[model samples]
Target: MSKFWSETVKRCVPYVPGEQLNDANIVKLNTNENPYPPSPKVVEAIKVEAERKLNLYPSPTVDQLRTDIAEYYGLSKDNIFVGNGSDEVLAFSFLAFFEAGKPIRFPAVSYSFYPVYCKLFNISYEEVKLNRDFTLPVEAFFQTDGGVIFPNPNAPTSIYLEIDAIKEIVENNPDQVVIIDEAYIDFASESAVSLINTYNNLLVIQTMSKSRSLAGLRIGFALGNSDLIEGLTRIKDSFNSYTLDRLAIAGAEAAIKDTNYYKSTTREIIHTREWITAEMKKRGFHILPSQANFIFVSHYNKQAEELYAALKDRNVLIRHFNKPGIDNYLRVTIGTNKNMELFLNKLDEILA
Candidate 1:
């Protein structure tokens, strides 16, 4: 502990992201990143941007990229706000909306980062436990609070809450802010972007990290009412005027516009998820119904930690959380068919 550290800094427990190994041959399925390469269009866009604008600072507002995303989502420029990543957008949300006087509520087993954000921003929050089936309990959100934030296809569980359930919560709590982190929405059954027009209190945050295959570029955005967007913009302006550089803005715009490529890649991941889940079930693993590109599975007979370690030793890396209620589960990202085959082969040997 450093003596120069502030009280808040001293108490802070930072978010631990999934492992990124230097070993290229590892069959990485820990982080929920796209297994496919970004669209060729994205590569072209980045090259064009880098060649033309090495000396100039990126557009302070990143207007063109925001407009492209807005048009793609059928929202106006005023309804959208862009940031370095969804984590930054979410941090701004916590600062701009969630407050200490009232308690923000989210699923007990949702994104691990939510609690970290709360601590970072000093936002008082409460954890509402998920039901036995690992689904969000919409009725639990009825209590009074500062705001609410939860992933649609909640992390580590890969369970999704239908848009109707979200609307039910929004319609009931018109006074509080409801931020739905839709980082995994592209792989999910549906999106809540359609509900933004009707509910001013609802803000949907998404990232290019997962389905868009632009995690390295670090671009994310939020869609909401103009006022909510304005609040995020204010927070963003105070922090970093040029959060997105020229290459990132250009690449994200190209990715968003390449609807065909995006859809094709996500569809492939979903298909692989289905096959893997079924196969794992046949091998005695209880796989949760996943709407995201990852599957959360637990075997009745095998230990999750043992499986994770065994896979890692074989140059395959999958994620296992050793926390309460989910200690036995492994969250495995859906990779390409070949990667999945390799993983399954390793599993066969390990289980045998």
Candidate 2:
């Protein structure tokens, strides 16, 4: 309520990120972070880069890292754009593509950050409701006034929409930009990145924080038609030239190049997710069919808030959204097998 606050600053309702407790003993499953450490190659690359270039500014164009990501995704460096994280990339997209009066469209229960970004940018938006089963209504996103954006396997729900469905949405909205945030696509069945070569209006943004076990390293990128890449580049250049540091560029390049380690760790997380789903269902939780590394679920009898508090008391943390219609559901990241076992044991004690 101070005169120092601008109208924009006063209007801002910032996104509340998952709790980052400092307790080393806490089993954190709230944020969908990889339980494993970043690949040894990523660490080595960072160490090498850190020793050589802490004083010099990073590449504003981020040429080599963009090249590495493009090579991995079978695209050209011109088709890629890198930023601090997908959140920043998304923020730039909202400014670059979506307009103030012309409202954009996203799922009513999709990633919470989408609405926050819309508010911050003063872009009007419509939240098209998902189907009762939590699947995206592809037609609802068609012919949007401004543009469209949503996570593929939507956040908190963890239900994946197929690429064919995605293609349909893109095809339907020929004039509008369709941004697909694929932060969890590595753990999923497939990626919409395959469709970008054919659809000029599609932009697929991804992060290294989840599947690559580099949450501590703030790196995210986008792949699309070279034009969209240029648009994001314009927005980025207008603000800051170097969104990625030297160490981040090197580590991200290494993470992109280390495909084998990424595959093994992603496979393990999928396996853990499968077993955890079964275990939770056996204990009366209604689980979504998750292709991502986390599970969205609700207990048959227990309240989500109560369960969340009980788990926190046991030193195990999971996410519980306080929003309407999903206040009873919790989103749990799939951890190591031993971690899941310990979580299950803690839950049994609470439920018993």
Candidate 3:
């Protein structure tokens, strides 16, 4: 470690994202990115904005884009907070709501970024263990000392918690902020955003990367009561007034408006996920019931690391975490139908 590094940098353990390969022939599925391209309207809007003004700085508040997202979710602009990405919004939230000494609670196997944020911000946290079935033990989050956060349709396992259970957690923690990272919510049943109006302490963060096919543009937003939104805004403005660029704002506005296009794409991914699940079961894989666009699975006879290496050798990539309690499982993102067929055919060969 460098002697010049601060205490925060010294203690931080950075999150390792999924492997990103540059090979054109690889069937990439390690990251849960949308398989389809963004809507045509998004591209056109970006092109128009690109030609308008290249020299001037973008809007500091990003007002119009916030309005568009608010309208899409039947909320007012005051209830919205926009950032460069969901990760940034989440970072700002950790700084805004959670305290240094108070311990927060989150699912043990949920998104890896939560712990990273806690460490970076010097916040105390407890990892709430999941049930035997890998489902969230909702009551475990009741009355946290600091606050609570976890993904709905929890990551890596792809097990979704119902909105009723989320409401229970929120109601139980009336004094603490409950942040729901709904990065993959478009592929799931329902959103906790509908309950934001009822619960003043709830904040629901979402991204355009998965459902709207805008990972390249990096647009994410949060929905909550006006007070919570103002808190996030304060944290953001303190750091960077212009968190998003003009192109991103334009593209996101177009993306949120093109609801039908994303809905069709989301349906297609869900269909592919179900088909792949059935195929994997036929090949002796034990899979979880997934509500997200990815599936968590394990083989009856093979080690996860061995399977991961074998697939990588064949120009196919999937995620296999080396952590304890889940070393045998793999998280596979739902690709296109053709891509999935190739993956399944390769798995058949491996199993044989």
Candidate 4:
């Protein structure tokens, strides 16, 4: 709207994240954040780093954290690229690999941020519609004009694609880069990272925000061949050299080292998800077989909009997208057992 604004700025349509309410009493589950606190080791390491270096800048290369993450995934530091968050890494990938004239392919109902990024960067993209069951159509992504990127255990729908199908897509798109956003992979069955060594074009991106309980820390990384990592690094260096602070670096390192704690929390979330799915089905909700930490459902007798408003009024928040084809569905994060119980109680009251 401003006269001084450039064409790029004017054309941008920013992504809208979930509402963040600070009320302690509300059972918050709109965003897919970990319900448990981070590991004690992570907190302690962050505290130690905070006291040691308040004046100095964090390592520009972020070598140590990258090494730790690489070790965790059985990859070398050269194959990894750390960023402020997975969103930042994805942005870098968009600039590094995708071209403005060539078109990229992604799921139509996958991460909402893909379209936002494409629009921002002037990148032409093809939105391949998902199958009737909300599962990705593997064949549709083969031989893309530019490249491809999509969340593994896709967002909003919470449906996970098998690794075999992912391999097929990567094999077919041997010429172009295939970026797999694995933000929710910890809660899912398998990771596409296993295919990175076999396929040079595959880039697997992950985040500490979901399963590692570091949403506030904002740590995310990408795993790919050294060449693709170098490309991401070039984009990052052009944008901002010091994307991560000392606290985030230290916290992420500790989080990667403390695998047992995070795994325990992940198991709990999966258990809670199973229980919640059964409970919702008992209430006449048809839910997808979710492999992530959230569930997508639509009630047989209730409207999604009405349910969202009713839950909000009861201080139990969940997500309801007003977009076509999925307007009737709601995406609810799997919170703690207590939080889920409260949500179900509120739902029961509404149903009554």
Candidate 5:
């Protein structure tokens, strides 16, 4: 507690990222990162850019990457914006669109960063409780006058809502900004980007960190109407004109363009997730139907913290959040098939 800290700084509670342990032999599945390595094309692109452009700043607009994303998603460059990471993009969004005095609304069970962002920006917010089964309730959002945000296939719980349900919420509240954080949308059935043409207030945020296997490069983007993108751009330009380095821009563009590689990897991960879910259910664990690259499960007989400790002792790590309703569950990332088999075997041993 330094006396030099400003009042606003003292009040801020930063988001905690998942642990990245250095133990080489550990089966790391805590973070919801892609288990496969990034496409070889991404590495080649970075190498080419690194050789020639160490002295110059990256394109401030990130025009080429923006155009690539726009073309991929069938949107205009005016509707897309990029940032250092989805977290920064989210920060800019909270500052630019959700600072109104009205209380912002989101799911009680969602990405943990939402509360941190609200506190960091000093915006008043209320949690609209998820339904009895952890699904988002469309009616819970109808009474609110403020902005709305929630992750699709909502995190920690890994439950997904249909696109029609999301459109109902957005169309119902056309006046307020409704942000859909889709960091795991690639694994889901549908994306909110499809609704952007109809709902001007809809802002869909995504990141390369999850599906594209580029978390190390730190690239993320937002898709919305031109006006909303402009607002985010204003906040970003005022903060850092060159949030992405040259290598990042090059690598991300390459990754986005490598459609075959990205699709193949995601398919494999989804397959692994299904197998893992079936096996866990056989072991008497209640597993949520997940559309993301992770599964949320809890056993009726074993405590989550106790299982987490046992797994850690065996050098296999998974995420266990001690938050109120979800304290008994473990959120396990979909790892390679071999890794998952090892995890299940170790769990059987620990339980025995």
Candidate 6:
């Protein structure tokens, strides 16, 4: 507790992202980053923008990019909100909608970021427990003191709750906002984006980092009713009117518009996730039912930390959370075929 530390800093419990080891030889499956590169269009768009507009500031409203994203999702620009990344969008959402006195609700085992955001914003919250099987208990999220926010697939567990269940939560919380963090939805079966037009309180947040393979570009967006979008926009403009720079805006625009590239990459990741799930099961790991570009699993006999440590020693890294209830599990990102083959081979060696 330094004297210089503000109350916010003192209360904040920061989120620990996946380890980013710089070893070229490592097979990284800890972070759920796409195993592919951004589309050629994304590359070309970024280059063109860089040459033409390095001297000019990016559009604060981000109109063209928002319009492009809306067209892709069959919504209007007014229904969209773009930020530096989904993390920023989420931060703005907490400040814009959730109040400090009214505690919001989210799954206990959900995105690690939710609690951190709650702490940073000084917003009170309740951690709704997930089912024993790691699925979200929709009934428990109903009629919250504040609003509701949770990942669609409920991170680390990677168990997707259907939209019908999501609708019930939204309908029940009619007076408050219900934010769905769909960072992994592109890899999943469906998105709750369809519910935005139907529910004024629904906000579906997504990122171009994963499926779009632009993790370096730092782009994320939110889809919601125009009012919710406006609220987020007000918060964003208050903080940084130009949250996304010119390069990021151009790259994100191309990423959103190139539907064909996203489809092919997304399909490949899904295929890889399925194959890896089956293989892990055969190896005696209890794999969770994942609809994302990653799989959550636990070896029947191996400790998660021990496996994690052993893999890191061999330059094959995956994620292991130390928090209870999920301390035994590991989250493995679906890499390219060759990368997965290497990961499996390394696992075999470690098991042997």
- Residues 157-183 of candidate 3 have per-residue lDDT tens digits of 999999999999999999999999999
1 against 3, candidate with superior lDDT: 3
lDDT of 2 by residue, 181-201 (tens): 999998888899999889999
| Clash numbers, per candidate | 0, 0, 0, 0, 0, 0
Candidate 1 lDDT, tens digit per residue, 96-151? 99987799899999899998988887889999999999998899997456878899
Best by lDDT: 4
Candidate 6 local Cα displacement, residue 99, angstroms: 1.3
The digit string of per-residue lDDT tens for model 5 on 12-118 reads 89888888999999999899889899999999999999899689888999999999999999999999999998999999999998874889899888998998988
Model 6: residue 220 alpha-carbon error in angstroms: 0.4
Q: Model 1, stretches more than 4 Å misplaced?
A: none
Clashing residue pairs for model 6: none
Candidate 3 Cα outliers beyond 4 Å, as residue runs: none
lDDT accuracy of residue 298 in candidate 2:
92
Q: RMSD (Cα, Å) of candidate 6?
A: 0.8
Report the C-alpha displacement of residue 74, candidate 6, in angstroms.
Answer: 0.9
Enumerate residue pairs that collide in model 3. none
Q: Clashing pairs in model 1? A: none
Q: Give the TM-score of candidate 6.
A: 0.99
**How high a TM-score does candidate 3 get?**
0.99
Regions more than 4 Å wrong, model 6: none
| Model 2 residue 26 lDDT score | 99
lDDT of 4 at 223: 97
Q: Which tens-of-lDDT digit does each residue in 189-298 have in candidate 4?
A: 99998888899999999999999999999998999999999999999999999999999999999999999999999999999999999998999999999999999999
lDDT of 2 at 292: 95
Question: What TM-score do all the candidates reach, one by one?
Answer: 0.99, 0.99, 0.99, 0.99, 0.99, 0.99
Better of 4 and 5 by lDDT: 4
* Candidate 4 TM-score to native: 0.99
